[model samples]
Target: MTGIKDVARAVDMSTATVSRALRGLPGVSDETRVRVMETARRLGYVPSPGAAALASGKTRTVAVVVPFVTRWFFAAVVEGAEEVLRDRGYDLLLYNLGGDEAARHRVFETSLLTKRVDAVLVLSLKPSPDELIRLDHLGRPVTVVGADVPGWATVRIDDEQAARHATDHLLDLGHRRIAYVGGAVEGVLDFTAPAARLAGYRAAIEAVGIAPDAALEADGSFTVAGGVRAGHRLLSAPERPTAIFAGSDEMAFGVLRAARELGLRVPEDLSVIGIDDHEMSVIFDLTTIAQPVREQGRIAAQQVLAALTAQYWVPEQVVLPTRLVVRRTTAPPSDG
Candidate 1:
C-alpha cells in the first residue's frame, strides 16, 4: 500500500515536510507544496485519516449545516463550498436538518459535531441565544452564510437593499398600489433574509410618500404555493395591487401562475418583480435582484480554510453586492 514515506522519498523531501504539505500546514513554500502534492498523487499515496487526526489533532473535515438540501440556494452554496474544500484537501460532512425545528435544536444543542469537524459552515440560520452559547462552547471555527452573527465570520448579500431595489423598480414604473409576498417576519427556522427584505420594501415605498399598508403585504412563506395563495388573496381584494414584489424567485413564479389563472396579463396588467434570479427565473422572463449565491458559499468555505490554516486569523463579515436584472416581467402599469 502507498504511504507518506514513499511519497516523501519520491518527492525528495523529508517525511515531516511531506506531512505538513499534505495537511495544508503553514511554513511550507508554495512550490514545494505543489511538488509534494503532485508526487503524492502520482505515487497513489492515500494518508490514513485516523493516523493523521491523531498526529495533528484535527479531523480535516468541515461540517456544513443547512435547513434542507433540496432547495436550489442551499444546494448551490454546498456545491461551491465542497469544491473549495476538496481543492484544499478537506472532506465535507453535511448535517441536513431537513427543515425540522426539533432536528435543528438537537444538532445545535449537543456536541454531535465537536470532535468530528475542524470547523462548521452554517447556512441561512440565525442562531438563538442558547444555540449561540452552545456553538461558542464548541471551540471550533464557525462561519455563517446569509446571517450576521457577532464574533463569527459571515458571508451574505444585503437583503434589505436587494428588496428595496426590487420595490423601487416597480415604484419607478408608477405603480402605487404595490403588494409584497414574502416569508413571515417570525418564521420557525428564524431566517434573516425575510425580515430584512420586508424592511427594504417598506422603506422604499415610504420614501416615495406611500404609507406602508398592512393589507397589501401577504405572507408567501417563501414558497411557490404560499406565493400563489398570497397572490390570489391580494388579487381578489376589493382594491387589487397593480404590481407585486416577491421575496424570492420561486414565490414570484407562483405569483405569475396565479396571475395566469386569474387571466391577468403580466407587465401590462399586473407587473411583478422578485429576488435571487433563480435559474428558472429566465424561463419565466422574471425581472429580479440577482445575488451571487454560490460565490457566497465559496467565500465562506475559504474563510473556514483561512481560520484552520493560519496561525492568527481574524473573523470578517463579507457582504456581497446584488444587482437588478431586467426582463419581460416588469413594466409601467397600464392605465385601466
Candidate 2:
C-alpha cells in the first residue's frame, strides 16, 4: 500500500518533486533524485502504471514490433531494449508479426491501435507507405531498428557495407571462386535487406575485375536450413567455390554442416565467412562481420524514450559500425 506520498514524506520533499525525480524529469536536483529514489525503494513504494498513465498522459510502455522474435538478432535487440526500458521505469509490449503478410497487416491495423504505449520501436521490419501511414496515425513517436525510414528515428548497421567487407575479406584471401548465400532475390515486399546484401557481394566481386556469376549465388533465406539446402546445391556443382560468404552466421553454420556432410575441410576445401557474429558463431568458429545488434536495439529504445519524454523529437538516422572478425573458418584458398 506504500505510495509516492510515503516516499515524499520520508525524503522531506513535496509530492511533485518525488514524482519528477521518479519519472526522471528535469527540475529535480541529482541529490534530491537519488534521495527520493532511495526512499522510494526503501519504503517499497511502487508507482501504479495505470495511475501514472492517467496523470501524465503517457502509458510508460513501448511497443516493439518485430518480424521474428525467435531469430538471434531480433531476440538480442529485444533484450537490449527491454533492459533500457526497465531501467527507465517503463514496460515493453511485444508484437511478433511472424514474418507473415497477414499477421503483419493484423498487427498494424488492430493490435497496435488497441495498445496503450507511448512509443513504438520496430525491429527489422520495413513498413510500407501504407503501413507507415497507419503507424503515423497511432500518434506515437516511432523509432526503427535495422533500416532507415524517412521521417523517423532509426538505428541500424550498414548491411551493404557489412556484406561487402565480408566478401572483400574472402577476396583478399585469394578466393577467386567465392559463392554467396543469402535470401531469395525476389518475392518479398518492404524488405530490401537481401537485395542490399546481394548488391554488396556483387560489387566486391566486380571491383576485383571478376564477372559476378549467378551460378555462384544461392538463396539461403537467412536461415540455417536454407543455408544447408543452398550449400548442397553449390557444393554439388562440378566446379565448386573455394570460399563461401554467407549473409548470416546461422547460414554460415549451415554451410559448415553441409561441408562436413560432403567431406570438405573448412579453409582447405571451402573457406566460409558470414555477417553477424552471433553468440553461436564462436562455437562454430565462424569468421564474420560483427555488427552491434544489441547496441542498435538499445539505441532505438533510447530514441523512442527520448521522444516520449519530450527530450528529443527530431527524427534522425544512426548507423553503427561493423568489424571483420577473423576466425578459424576463414583462410587463404588452398589453391593459393
Candidate 3:
C-alpha cells in the first residue's frame, strides 16, 4: 500500500512538509505543494484518514443550506458551488429547508450543530438574528449567496439596481402605464429580493414623473402559476397597463400565456419584461435583466474555501452585476 513515507521519499522532502502540502496547510510554497501533490498522484499514495483528521482538524466537507432545490436559481447555485467543492477534494452536505418553518428551525438549531462540516454556504435563505446567533456559535466559516448579512461573507447582485434597470428598459420604450408582477411583500421566501425589486420599480416610475399606482401592481408569488393569476387580474382591469415587469422569468412566462389567451400580441399589445434570464428565455424571447446566479454560487463557495484555508479570514460582501437583455417581448406600446 502506498503511504506518506513513500511520497515523502519520492519528493525528497520531510514527512511533515509532504503532509502539509497534501492537506493544503500553510507551511509550504506553492511550487513545493504542486510537486508533492503530483508525486503523490503518480505513486498512488493515500493518506490515512485518521492521521489526516488529527493533523488538519478538518472534515473536508461543506454544508449547503437552501430553501428549495426545485427552483432554477437555487439549483443552478448548488451546481456551481458543488463543482467548486468537488474540484477542491471536498464533499457537499445539502440541507433543504423545504420552505417549512419547522424544518428551518431544526436545521439551525440541531442539524447544523451536529454536522462535521468545515464550512457552510447558505443559498437564498436569510437567517434571522436568533438563527444568525446560533450560526455564530457554531464557529464554522460561512458564506452567503443572494442576500447580504452582517459579519458574513456574501455574494449577491444588487437587487434594487437590477429591478430598476429592468423597469428603466420599459420606461425608455415609451411605456408609462407600467405594471409590476412580483412576489408578495410578506409571504415570499428570500424576503429581501422581492422588496428590493419592488422598491426599484417604484423608484424608476417616480423618477419618470409618474407616481406608482397600487392598482398596477400584482403579486405573482415568483412562480409561473402566480404570474398567470396576476396577469389575468392586471389584464382584466378596466384600465390595463401598457407594459408589465415581472419579478422572474417564470412569472413572465405566465404573463405571456395570459396575453395569448386574451388575444393580446406581445410587444404590440402588451410589452413585458422580467428578471432572471432563465434557460427558456431564449425560447420565449422574453426581455429581461440577467443575473449570474450560478457564478454567484461558485464565488460564494470559493470564499468559503478561502476562509477554510486562511489562518484569519475577514467576511467580505461581493456584489456582482446585472444587465438588461433585449429580446422580442418588449417594444413601444401600440398607443405610442
Candidate 4:
C-alpha cells in the first residue's frame, strides 16, 4: 500500500512534513498542505486510521447531537460545522433526535457514549440535570451550541441580547406598541433560546417605562404555520400592536403572510423584526438580528477539539455575537 513516505518522496518533501500536513497540524503551511494532498491523491495513498489512533490516542472523530434536522437553522449549523471538521482531518458522526422524547433519552443514555470519537458536539439537545451529569461520565471532551451546559464549554449567541436587539430596533423606529411572537415547549432541552429571547423583549419594553402586556405576547409552534396562528392572535385583538418581534425568521415570514391575508402591508400597516436571519429573510426583505449560527457550529467543533487535544482552554461560556440587519420590512409605525 502507498504510504506517507512514498507520497513525501513524490512531493520531494520530508516524510515528517508530509505527515504533519496530512494530519492538519498548524506547523504546515498552505502550500505544503496542498502539495501533500496532491501527492497523496496522485499516489492513491490512504492512511491507516486505526494505527494512527493507537499512536496518537485520538480517533479523529467527533459526534454531533441535535434534534430536528429539518430546520434551516440547524442544517446551516451542521454545514458550517462539517466544513471546519473535515478540513481539520476530523470526521463527524451525526445523531438526530427526530423530535421524539423517547429517542432523545435513548441517545443520551446510549449512542453518544459508545462512539470512538475524541470529543462530543451538541446542538441544542437539552440534557436533563441528570442527563448532563451522566454525559460527563463519557470522559471525552465536550462542547455545545445554542444553549448552556454548566460543566462543559459552549459556543452560542446571546439569546437574550439577540431578542433585545430586535425589540430595540422596533423601539428605535418609534414602535411603542410592539408585540412579540415566540415558541412554546418543543420537548428539546436545547430549546431554551426562545424563552430567553422573550425575556429580553419584555426587559426592553420595561426599560422604556412601558408596561409589557401579556396580551401582546403570543406563543405557538416555531414554524411558519405557528407564526401565522400566533400572528392572528396578536393582530386580531382590539388593541393590536403596530410592530412585531418574531423569535425566528420563519415566524417572521408567517407574520408577513398573515399581514397580507388580513389586507395589511408590511411596514405600512405593521413593521416586523425577527431573529436568525433565515434564508428567506433577505428575499422577503425582512429586517432582523442575525445570529452567527453556522459560525457557532464551526467554533463549537473547534472548541471540542481543543479540549480533547489539550491545546488551550477557553472560557466555560463562549458567547458568539449578533448584529442587526435592517431591510424594508421595518419602519416607524403609522400613527393612524
lDDT of 4 by residue, 1-336 (tens): 898889988988898788778877678999989989988998999988887777667789888887778888888998888998998779888878777777777778775456477787878755677777767788787787888776568888888989988999999889999999987745454587877888999999998999988899888567899899988888888888899999999999998888888888888989998998888889999999988888888888777767766767654788878999999999998879
For each candidate, how many residue pairs have backbone atoms clashing (under 3 Å)? 0, 0, 0, 2
Candidate 3 error regions (>4 Å): 1-22, 26-55, 188-190
Q: 333, model 3: CA deviation in Å?
A: 0.6
Best of the candidates, lDDT: 1
Model 4 TM-score, 2 decimals: 0.85
lDDT of 3 by residue, 1-336 (tens): 998999999989999999989987777999999999999999999877667866777878899988888888889999999999999988898988777777777788775544478888888767888878888888888898988897789999999999999999999999999999988676424567888899999999999899989999999988899999999999999889999999999999999999999988998999999999899999999999999988998999899898877888899999999989999999998854
RMSD of 1: 2.1
Q: What would you estimate as the lDDT of candidate 4?
A: 0.83
lDDT, candidate 3, equals 0.89
lDDT of each: 0.92, 0.87, 0.89, 0.83
Q: What residue runs in model 4 are displaced by over 4 Å at the alpha carbon? A: 1-40, 47-57, 185-190, 311-316
Q: Can you give the lDDT of residue 309 in candidate 2?
A: 66
Of candidate 3, the 10-residue stretch with the lowest lDDT total is 184-193
Q: Number of clashing pairs, model 4?
A: 2
Q: Across residues 4-107, which tens digit of lDDT does each residue of candidate 2 receive?
A: 88888888889999998987778999998998888898899988878877887778889898887898888999999999999888889998877787877787
Residue by residue across 51-74, what tens digits does model 1's lDDT show?
A: 899999999899999987887789
